[model samples]
Target chain A: MEYMIKNKNEQLTNWVNEYSDKLYSWAFYKTSKKEVAEDLVQETFLSAFKSFDNFKFESQPQTWLFKILNNKIIDYYRLLARNIEQVTDDEFLSKKTTDALFNNSGQWVSAPINSQWEEQEHLLDNVDFTTVLTNCIKKLPQNWRIAIESKYQEEKKATDICKELDITSSNYWQMIHRAKLQLKICIEKNWIIK
Target chain B: MRFFKLSCKKATEMVEKEKINGLSFIDKLRLKLHLSVCKACRGYEKQSTLIDDFFLKTSASDIDNIKIEENPKLKETIINRLDNES
Candidate 1:
């Protein structure tokens, strides 16, 4: 029994060496933070090592590892969502600047300020535009960021995202709407004007 | 006109809802009418779709191309944690 455990440990170590970079890259890509990504990768390996006996070995270790990592990412976002729910309110969705987009009668206050965006083809292909857009996304409130990331990065169903985040479906859509509004305004300010 | 008319705010919400959850028939019609007259909301729709497509396309393939610099110590750290666990 002891010998079996040791053998499993060695196998896990080999996997750690072989797949850590790939896993780390993926986690970083998902989270956009190095420390969080590293911690998640470490947790994934630890969890995998603990469950070594349960791994059927029919699937590649890489697949199993990624499945664990994906769950960790989801849990991380879920936690962020919960924390935001407790700490904040719907004010994030109804910022004064966003309110300024419309008049009291709910009519647009100005002409389309983003007409400049329409002129630019393949905006993401421009490295500077991509950089500015990335910064704009980062500037969103944490919950809004999670909302956008869960929708886009994870490609999750709206209902599933609401369940995972413990938010109502209405709240989920509202956050996505507000996040997109903020992103559009940010891009216009940072990229279009500059 | 008020019955068929949708506020720009409500129209924009419907626009977002169209992407998230398809709107009801009346709601769709109302938003369509609003956008027909509201150039600003039309701009909002175009920009919103652009941002959505940007994320959708990038999330599909951008990560594979991004090279996140590897941490040489990450392996050592995981191995040490495993050792501590056992």
Candidate 2:
């Protein structure tokens, strides 16, 4: 009995060392905050340890751990949404920026059509594109980042996101629209234009 | 043009919202009409959705760059706590 328990503890420790970095990276990708990611990773480990005996080993240990961390990310986002306050105005993006993109007659101000981005479909395989995307996501205001990441990456339902973020339907739609606009413009300037 | 008079701004918002939630029939009609006349808004819609498609397709990949290092003491703290509990 003593020997079996000792081996179990040893295996758990090994998991901590092996999976910690992968788990941290995933958590950071979801949260985009180092401290929150670290905390979630720690929480995941601790929870796994407590429930260690219940794990059936049907799935790979890494898969099991990832499942727990994914749950943690969702819970974090849900909590954030519940606690977030509604914004009174368009705080970060300005009307002038929107105007520059569209004219008084609701037409494109500059060239009506952008250069055909032939390579866009292949950008997924490009590490630099992902890096640029990550940087652009990071550049957004915290709420915008939260909104975009939750909506796009997590693929949460609009109503659920609105409930979590304490925003109305109109507010939710507007945020997503504005955030995507900014992201599109940012990518065009950095990746396509240059 | 009045019935189908969706401005570029409103048309773009509808385009973005259409990805997650279905757009209203009138809004959809307006967007289609606007896109028919407005090449820039059309380009914006296509490119904006492409950005979304890029994220959805690539998010599943093993692209790791923003690495977060756990505090060295975290393991020790967890182990100690578990020990105390047991």
Candidate 3:
């Protein structure tokens, strides 16, 4: 019994050292915020440590770690939902001036465009990108922040985020819309025109 | 109306992902109106279109070889946090 315990401890430590960086990178990509993703990675490892004894080796240790990380991400999001009060529309949008009516039918691409839209030149311009978005995210209500992070940073689909948050389809879209509006204002305030 | 017409962020996001279509009629019109008058939106539209084109043309691996900065004390930091969990 003593031998089994010692051996498992050694193996888990090795496992931690080997996979931590890759897993941290994955988490970083999903969460965007370095500190938050690092915190989650630590939580993932702690959970793995506790459950090490029960691991039956049905899957590789990496796969097992993945399962744990997925649950931790979901829980982190759920806990935030509970703590933050629901966001109201006006608090979300600066104001609804009646300048442009929404036209939902806009095609994603308008005739292939000039194709310069995706140029790496613009993406890597090191332009004051953050100057544009600095306070935009802060203005969002907590719930909307989670939705946006999951949507873009995590690359989770709207469907999956809605399912995880237990929000209806309409509510999900509305929160996304409000988040985008705030972001737009921030972008407009900071963009450098050539 | 001013915000909607002037803001091209939506168009930029969609164009980045090569994801278009599924917008409603009114949304399309609003976007068009925004694009017609707004220089910033026009620039964004141009930039996004180019980014997509580059990705489509580049056959190389999407993976970037970013140098990893080890938090030398990261493990210790995490271990200390775990100890406090009790």
On TM-score, the candidate that comes out on top is 1
RMSD of 1: 3.1
B1-86 in candidate 1: lDDT tens per residue? 77998888888888877777778898888888889988778878888888877788777774448785677799999999898888
True C-alpha contacts between chains kept, each model in order? 0.62, 0.45, 0.07
Candidate 2, position A135, lDDT:
79
Encode model 3's per-residue lDDT on A60-147: one tens digit a residue.
8887886787667767766665444554674545424101222344322242233222233554344465434445565655566765
What Cα-based lDDT does every candidate model obtain? 0.80, 0.70, 0.54
Can you tell me which runs of candidate 3 are displaced by over 4 Å? A18-39, A53-67, A82-84, A87-142, A152-156, B1-74, B77-86
Q: How good is the docking of model 2, as DockQ?
A: 0.48
- TM-score for each model: 0.84, 0.78, 0.52
Pick the winner on TM-score between candidates 2 and 3: 2
- Writing each residue's lDDT as its tens digit, candidate 2 over B1-86 gives 67778877888888877765678888888888889988767877877766676666656655355555655666666566556645
> Can you list each candidate's DockQ?
0.60, 0.48, 0.13
Instruction: Return whichever of 1 and 2 wins on DockQ.
Output: 1
Task: Tell me the spans in candidate 2 whose CA falls farther than 4 Å from its real position.
Answer: A1-11, A82-96, A103-107, A111-132, A155-166, A192-194, B63-71
lDDT of 1 by residue, A37-132 (tens): 999999999899888988997889988998899889888887776665543554445466677877999887775555457457777688888888
